[model samples]
Target: MTTDTLVMPSVTAPPHSHRLRQVLHDSGYALLSLPVGVLFFVVVVTGLAAGIGTVVIWVGLAVLALTLLAARGSATLERAQLPTVLGRPVPRPAYLPGEGGPVRRLLTPLRDPQSWLDALHAVLRLPLAVLAFSVTVTFWAIALGGITYGLWDWALPQEGNEDLFELLGFDGGTSLRIVGYTLIGLLAAAVLPFAVRAVAVLQAQLGRVLLTSRAATQAELGRLSRGRDAAVAAEAVALRRLERDIHDGPQQHLVRLGMDLSRAQRQLDRDPSAARTTLAGAGVLAREALEELRALSRGIAPPVLADRGLAAVLAALAARSPVPVELAVDLPGERLAPATENTAYFVVSEALANVAKHSGADVCRVEVGLVGDVLRVVVEDDGTGGAVLVPGHGLAGLADRLRAVDGVLTVDNPRGGPTRTVAELPWA
Candidate 1:
């Protein structure tokens, strides 16, 4: 035989209107749900005691080389049951501390607050959900049955009407009918809705208490994570820049210098004048290598960019580039963090370089302005199509550099050309 399981859709009131009413109703119901609260409190406190005791027992057993499977198994079930009833997501119990030895498992429970809370939540959930669910269900059943019975009695208008209302545990004749009908209306309009809302609010509160971090703590963690991401990106860019500088600059020059020396040796036997010319070429190559190394060092976190700030550095880079650059800078010299300023300078420099080398654009525009807490830099070029993220290129390095400072780089290279690279760096 084939069986089909029916899935019921969730019924929740609208967030603004119905939800708000539900919240208020739940707040008032919290006190009325006193028995449930007390029961939950007892269960939670007891579970905490048991869990702590169990950990101690496990440690003692581990010292004797006795199996601890039973203790661990029990704790696992206790914690798992919490999420089922409370409707809050809680983690399951993993291996206790000190599985490697007696000291670890014993100390593990002490170190973790969540472990203790999990045990406590599990122990308390059953009592709380049971008491609260029971009271809510009972009240609803009475209100519904009373109203329904009374209405049937009133409509029938016979000797059996009195018996039906009485059986429903209501007052005599008209009085019974009125009370039952009134209760039905009130339950439908207020009581039932309030009960469901109260349960949800309580569940949310418990979930937050046992699961999610506090608002302030979460905000702090988010900030730290962003800062870390930026730092990592910056380091990555620095490494790439070092690699490129070595490959294109000093390394290539040194190889050529070596070849020139070999040529000089060959010429020295036949023609001394030719040998002198080769030596002169090697000298020139050595000087070129030194200049390339210096340039690479400067790119690896330049002191000039740090001391003078971003605007000056960018202006210098733009003035020196092969392409003509029009810089419109509006940032206050003292308002930027050293990191933020350095990253911005690189973004503009890299973008302009791309324009000169690849974009085939004649003229480029660079603008730096502060918008509230963030510094916005725009580099636009009327160049050929296709500016994409190519690994190891200036554009990719620029993106990494900006990200290191909690900044973002957006390259809008539409099909028709005219690529716009906008970099936003957050002020410290």
Candidate 2:
């Protein structure tokens, strides 16, 4: 037998490599800030100047409006460039659209608060950008020049000039000059990345604060609120359903078993044969209740899931299923988040249970895999199909549970043949 080993490139970057990459990005961004800042400042200042100077005529109103629009455009460009420094995209905010005539719409930028903020950012950023550019460039120059001082020292005019060490008044020589400057170079090099990143962040942060959209933020908050409410509702519904199932299934079975055992004890003294029959019935009821309780426990956080993860637990579930199940599941090597694994487990468990109870199919097929940033689970069966998501029903409960985790469940059950149920959850 021959063995083939295929090597794959590692995806996780080393700490030092990541640090170097970030430093390069910060350095590039910092170096570019001065020119970008200058362009913004000059444009904004000139436009405002012309607009204010022409205020005597109605033409000044149009100038001021156009200037505000230009400021907004500059702000947009600045925001787009920030992700290279911040390592994330800035949210774009919604602007108010004016109703009615052409002039009101043209002047809409003046009325918006975000537009004003953007314009303010354009004006204020120039000073910070200048500071950042000076510090970053000075530090880089010192580090480079000092480190390479020895290589270029002979070319400089040595007759009438004092080197850095000589100017300090201690001493002056070729050896001293090289060693002293090299030390300074090493020190500056050590702090160069941090210094550059700090200044770049200062400049980029202003744009983020001014340019981030309020509407986008509010939409995100609303999504989280809805998820919270769904979680609460789903938990309540699950608890109630569990209580109902216990009451109607194993709870009633145990009660009947107790009554049968009591009857058997009472009959034992008078009629031995009658007592034996009652005892046998009680034994059957006891076994049934035990099995039902075991099934309920399987739906919960089983130890196998924590030890062996979703794949193993799913294999066990498929083995126990009444309908023959063909499971094809591909998962990552590491364990998923606890809540995600639990939700996925229950989705499959409930889905298989439905296939057995309602589908009445000879065979069922289950496919599960991570599709990009989503965990998708699909169960299909060749059975008589009439499934629906009615309120307070199993399918409805599944829908609610999926929604709690920002997941969705859909079923395609036609009149007479096959049924397919698909559930997709975020890869949280």
Q: Which stretches of candidate 2 lie over 4 Å from their true place?
A: 1-14, 49-57, 97-100, 213-216, 221-357, 361-428
What lDDT tens digits, residue by residue, belong to model 2 across residues 1-428?
A: 11222222232322685877877777777778788778878878887888789979877767878877888888878777777777777677777778779988977877887777777777998998888889889889989988988899889988988776788886757898898988999888878877887787877877776677554565677778887877777677778877888899899999999999999999999999999999999999999999988877786668899999999999999999999999999989888878788888888888888888888899999998999989999989999976788877777777877887888999998899698999999875
Which residue pairs collide in model 1, if any? 97-104, 97-105, 98-104, 98-105, 230-404
Tens-place lDDT per residue, model 1, 77-126, is: 43343343334465442334456565665556554544444444445455
Residue 57, candidate 2: C-alpha displacement in angstroms: 4.2
Give Cα distance to truth, residue 426, candidate 1, Å: 2.1
TM-score against native, each model? 0.58, 0.55
Off by over 4 Å in 1: 1-39, 51-111, 117-211, 214-237, 258-272, 283-287, 333-335, 390-394
Most TM-score-accurate candidate: 1
lDDT of model 2 at residue 151?
Answer: 94
User: Please, what is the whole-model Cα lDDT of each candidate in the order they appear?
Assistant: 0.64, 0.81
